[model samples]
Target: MAKFPLSDLRFYAVDTNVLIHDPNALFKFEEHRVVIPMVVLEELDKLKVGTTALAADARQAVRTLDSLLGAATPAEIMSGVAIIRAGGQALGTISILMPAQQSNLGLQPNSNDNLIINDLLVLKQSTEVADVVLVTKDINMRLKARGAGLSSEDYHNDQLISDMDSLATGYHHVVGSFWEQIEAIEPQRVSGDGYHQMNSATLQAILERKLYVNQFVYDDKEFVCRIYKEVGGLVTIELLNTALLMRQKAWGLAPRDLFQGMAMWLLFDPEIDLVALNGPAGSGKTILALACALEQTMESKDYRRIIATRSTRGLDEEIGFLPGTEAEKMQPWLGAFTDNLEALHAEDFDPGSSADYIGAKVPLQFKSLNFIRGRSFQQAFLIVDEAQNLTPHQIKTIVTRAGEGTKVVCLGNLAQIDTPYLSATSSGLTYMSERFKGFQHGGSISLQGVARSRLAAFAEAHL
Candidate 1:
């Protein structure tokens, strides 16, 4: 699994952003040396003060570091301390790179990043160097490190895919009849639903990648089937009527495209607990998700309420300064939901009043991501918007807050991520989709095309 090991182990000096991005990254480097600079510790100490997600991560990183260094003396810490795993197996050595005094590598004073680079430069020339490498999430820092004549790389342990185009789209689109590729199948009817059981190896070329329970296979011959069960090299496919799926509706909203139609089926079904919807702007991601939430909550009573939150920069810092309740403060960030609700009820006799009535009567709540931390929601539809902006660690923290009977819908356009130090391939949304690809109760659909307007669709394809 390792790229290279044994004699090729290099010293990986992690940056503050890397630690904040993932607290447990210290132990991820197996059998290699991990170095933490003194300036990094000072930065962590200064940041670990607030209840914000960033502060929480800082505190966790500090705690993890403190726990790892347990009772090591200053001299031993400077030399190296054995980094032990959870099972008490010593895998690698971790040490603090002391401040460099006589090194000529120091840049302009007062910047922790420059100071860390200075210390790393000195360490690179020391006897302990197998090959010095700086691991950082900051692109500019990586450039600076390389400019200062040092090895550097981005944190890739959590980046599952190397290319964004290789990401799963949750469905296989076949132009011809799907049965043309299948050699044989055991067909059955379960309580009026058509089911087919076939050897997975027979459909290897059609499937391409490994088959998952929630993935779909559709053909232009008016055939659509989902992999509902897989056991002992055989897959049980639940056949879905293409016409029926295209007619699926939620909260008086009909899908504009086949992708939206498929997404609505998955989001409306209580059997699936997590649905990841990603596409370009105006691909009906929010509208479809909101419609499904309202349908399940207000109409079917499947959920008690809808809890909405999104990843926006400076939300944690600016939300506390706003002059209202948490819901009121979050209203600005969650305008997409209200905006889509208005669209959903635009055909009503009084759209404004209808939207207001639902807002007043329905239990729709806007929550801050900061407040969502550590809180559990039961029988709730939790929509996490702009998930592409979240780190793998932050998304995991929020998703784990789901209590029994709660369904979490993560929506984002990977190409539209705004968060610094994140890429389409490295985004939390992509990470979650990849990690949950095989989950029996989770499904992801990368909605295709811009379904907003002719102008928007033209711009999406051309501009």
Candidate 2:
């Protein structure tokens, strides 16, 4: 809660983009009045005619408005509609900019955005509403509102953090005599597996922040490390054994860095159902995910088949439409999948014969994000590649589709998001990683160091 006085409330005139971006933006402003221009509603009506995410948001926002105005009379609605929440608790009032009340207000109604701003300009003079600010997701609308001498702000309730660095890396850097501190504590042996038990309070005090089960803790001084696991106020720490990783390979792909090694461990852990892999381009985000999926599905027979999907939108041009079946249409978008497959084949299989290489191709099913709704994946390894382009709602939809024995692996480079209106902080990849950081059954890793080539790494560092 802000420290400002509650009585000094302000009125926010919302734009169409804000409501479309987040349907519940109406109730986000606590104890502050929300004003809606008729032009915004007109824009929503036009946007509500499609099957896209924006269309769904538009319809939902309209439905929310209808419910708010359900018990109000026409006169009451014109003046102000009481905005009641789920518990019938009224936070504030919502008023629509009526046609009869539309004043010229020294601005032309040529554009709907301009008209919305003009609505606030007129309300500031005609009503006693303090601070008629225009809240929007559109940068141009916010600028125009401010240019007209009106207060403006971006809707920020959905934003979790402004900077990506604020997110947990799932790896804590322990410093200075960490082994001596552990040696001082007489830990009781948990099992034959080299796990030492410690007091939960002591562990919490030493770590400061709450450590998620399975989160890695490491010290650069001699690479002293442990994995965290807790049960009922009792915490267990196991010496991280990189020897097992050194002896193993997933579909002919080995971990290139410490972060990649941690990501691979999480991917191979059967106890974890969801794993998020984040990195820049050429960091093996896709390759690692694919290798883990193949190892689980084909080699280990842990799952039935692998289902791969990605946003059709690309960096340069979208794979707008293609002929043939879904697999054929998605082939262009699956270049990463094939590229990694070819690389793995060249590295793992006999180089003399193309037959072995062709046979080594894992059984894969291509899925489109648009058709993923109302479907459940059971006993399958579902890989969502290029997930940074996905919205938080889209990520939720995909994650919820997992059925029994289904593991979800989300892979993406946050710096390579092609979707408009998304940033590093707001990308679904970042949101998923941040939200599921400490969950017992979920894990996230941000891969560092490029593993592609010297040339690629140089280009990434400079360009």
Candidate 3:
């Protein structure tokens, strides 16, 4: 399904942010004709002057355009350049829509957006295309295009799930009786490894409700939770050690709710390489991840260091080039890190040594996504907070950097995504959770309970 091509191809007018969000969106249109406005190139030129991800995407889009139209003549560019992928495979036709005589969009001639709309209108009037659809990520741009009597749509080629709420929570509750459900299936001793296996028919019966590997299944009647581990063709269920989980405390923090306990289990698992946590604000996502990372790095001595990072994109702030060292520059964006550190340090009243001790004991390092390329993190516990602001490409880049013996935990609230071009469904956090749910070394959990103060929870619900 990932490599499926579009069947009903049509002329698609792409916007600047669409190209910036996915650099390979040019080739994603399949056999359809893609029209690029000249003004989009102008926007890309201005955005390509930075070291940010947007700049990298803009440069990549320009390079892709150059590679597609490089050998073509001016007349060919006017008509269309055949879009070819690597290895010289023909995919589709791409063309540049140049500015012509005055258009009648009733907007100012100097407006760049109106000019693009006018170009699309010109194509609709002159070309034989059955439909001219403007594909963009900007809602306002789509509204304006539709207001001008032009068809518009969101570019959904990069989205993993159509609805983010349909994602798995890595857990299910079995009501009524637990023994009644398991009495009929006799557990066969698969090996001497303390794991009993269920028969194929029993596994099929369990899978009728759809269970993922390493997903937690709980029974309220029996007050037991088991971790479903699929091995060979049979399903193995292990009783969750709730007593051990309840007795454990990491970095002076404890799981206050059952969902938080589930999150902690996934976060601290040595076998699970990637853990994703989603919830609303004050759900203990950041705090629990930091606590587990600190435990794994400092107390358990499992990982060498804890690397904490998040997308610097903000709703009301921008991460412009600042005048300072790396640590000094990233200080503003590490407020969550600072807050969690303070929470951990609140247990100690010793002012002088408490801060220094936490810093020295927890081998933690802060990183910016800007300079994370071409780097490998080995024997490290990497926590990516506010992951909802990242694109799927950025998440892929970050996760692929994990060398051997590295665990990555991504935490975020889908409702709080602040990135310009990302939605709850299209965010990297949602994409990762959907794609990694069935993997043996991956687990995800949705933390529903808010662990913050009463006032905060009230505001989240009523305000």
Q: Which lDDT tens digits does candidate 2 get at residues 1-463?
A: 1122234568788888778666788888888888888888899899887555556768888998888887888878766676888787988888787643556564677877777777677767655536678888677777888888888987777768888878777777667555655555544444666677777776666567777776777665544244557888878776665555445589878887778888888888898899988888899988888888889987899998899988645411223357878677777878888777777767444753643544456568887776677799999999999898877767887999999999999988888877656777877788888788768888888888788999999999999
Instruction: Write the residue-wise lDDT of candidate 1 on 68-169 in tens digits.
Output: 887899877876799989888998889887788844455665688888888878777663427889999999999999998999999999999999878999
Instruction: Find the candidate with the highest TM-score and give its number.
Output: 1
Error of 1 at 384 (Å): 0.4
Determine which window of 10 residues in candidate 3 has minimal summed lDDT.
1-10
Q: Per-prediction count of colliding residue pairs?
A: 0, 0, 0
Q: On TM-score, who's better, 1 or 2? A: 1
Q: How many backbone clashes does candidate 1 have?
A: 0
List lDDT for all candidates, in order: 0.87, 0.76, 0.79
Clashing pairs for model 3 are: none
Per-residue error for 402 in candidate 1, Å, reads 0.8
Q: Predict model 2's lDDT versus the native.
A: 0.76
Give the true-structure RMSD of model 2. 4.3
RMSD of each: 3.5, 4.3, 4.4
Worst ten-residue run, lDDT, model 2? 312-321
Clash pairs of candidate 1? none
What's the C-alpha lDDT at position 158 in model 2? Answer: 71
